[model samples]
Target: MSNLKPEPANAPDDPLRRTLLKGAGILAAGSLAGSALGLAPAARAETSAGLGGRLRGVQHFGITVQNMDRAFEFYTEVLGGTEVMRDGDFFGDRIQNTLLLTEEVRAVRDGVNPVTLGIPDLRSGAQRLDVRFIQFDNVVIELLQYRDKEQPTGSGKAFAPAQDLTSPAFPRAMHVCFYIRDDVDFNQFVRDLEAESARRGMSNVKANRIVRATTDEQRLGASLDSNTNRITEGPSAGWSLIYCKGPEGEQLEFVQVQGHAKQVFDGAYESRRKQLGA
Candidate 1:
């Protein structure tokens, strides 16, 4: 999805936050919210404190969504994400899938939308993000949307290139990524994406690119002060990343190359956790 400023530890919860968290990327609140949200640390501390072994692999990813209901419907009923954790939206006063750990959305979404409309109007549902969230499976996936966003950006705009193939379902500058297990099927999955996009008249879906990252870029990532994107530069040696965009100028990132993604995470997470001493 998108990333925003880190949440303050003392920042009290608010209703308007629902809009802010949607597509804000840096969600530090709500279900599954990370350190960005106060509860994540508590979850980690609760788990870590009790005692558990390191994970063999990532179990799930956390992301923001616009229409929690529609997303839930699409994911659970359509994609088959077993309901994990869900609750009410503090702001909208509506029921939402605050937390849903799914494995299906990761395998589809982009590919399916394209098939529904081949070379379709890039503006259609492209940027209309009704829902967004993370998925769980053999691999982890993150889905994002623009239609349901009500979050205040202080002042920011989506950037879309003029000549990029226009899409009605997924716009430019908007992006979400799926983290594939090292052994996850690659070719077969691409075929699935292609087939779905083609079926929907969105043959243009094949135009999308699949990128593989390197661990070197992950370590080389620039500091938090990196740039306007708040993106860190790759370490020049250990890791790197891949970037893609959907319709309406949403940016998607495949972060920290496989081998090196954890380098910085280890240092940063450890340091932050120690700082909190939680």
Candidate 2:
């Protein structure tokens, strides 16, 4: 998945942050690394009270869908995500009320296009939303079905280039990723993704390799290491990432950090729990 920012130019030289960066790759997978690292020292300086810090870690990913049952089948039957919690009515009152609170929603209701504000196509008529929360390993996935409204129709194709690791967009949140355990059959997982995409008639489900683990210098537009930025140091040394598109055009990443799960998946989890006294 996307929604991650590049590393900052001026991050403090805290030993703890350095250590965490080595293990957690500067920030969590879907985090704004630059912003997080930039504000970390300031957060520390201003907040010494209990449980006071920048965000601990990611909790879940949310997405709006057109069909609840179809999306549920793809996530549950295909990806094997376990259902955790779900509560919503097909009427969409709660969801519409929540959306109406946002400036983008208001602008759309005024019959103005909102693509620049990241709110594309104002849907007319009743807006309905039902939700399904699923857990894939440690990450929680939220699937929302928003319907009964007029939305710009599409050919149901995803065209964004996959090579752009950072999918720079208006609402920068681009994708959701899942960790592939060291013991899992990697080939089978890839096959499964391909099969699911084919089943849904989406041709965008192809795998792309992340040749290098991102570095702060790289974030500044430095040339990649001649060796192709292969993981040579840190917890993810020698690791690789592969990604694909889901049925409804959502980017899905499956990371393979050989020998162990990335600290972002396992370690950051503990850190967040400790931060929350869980």
Instruction: Report the Cα lDDT for candidate 2.
Output: 0.49
Query: Candidate 1, residues 174-227: lDDT per residue as tens digits?
Result: 345544334534433444433553454432232123332254244224332221
Per-candidate RMSD, Å:
16.6, 14.6
Q: Residue 82 deviation, candidate 1, in Å? A: 6.0
TM-score of 1: 0.35
The TM-score leader among the candidates is: 2
lDDT of each: 0.34, 0.49
Regions more than 4 Å wrong, model 2 = 1-57, 90-97, 104-125, 149-171, 200-204, 209-235, 259-278
For model 2, where is the 10-residue window of minimal lDDT? Answer: 152-161
Strongest candidate by lDDT: 2
Residues 134-252 of candidate 2 have per-residue lDDT tens digits of 65644567776543334221122111222334342537657776666667666556665666666776554554433443653342243322212235477677565556656656676
lDDT, residue 219, model 2: 28
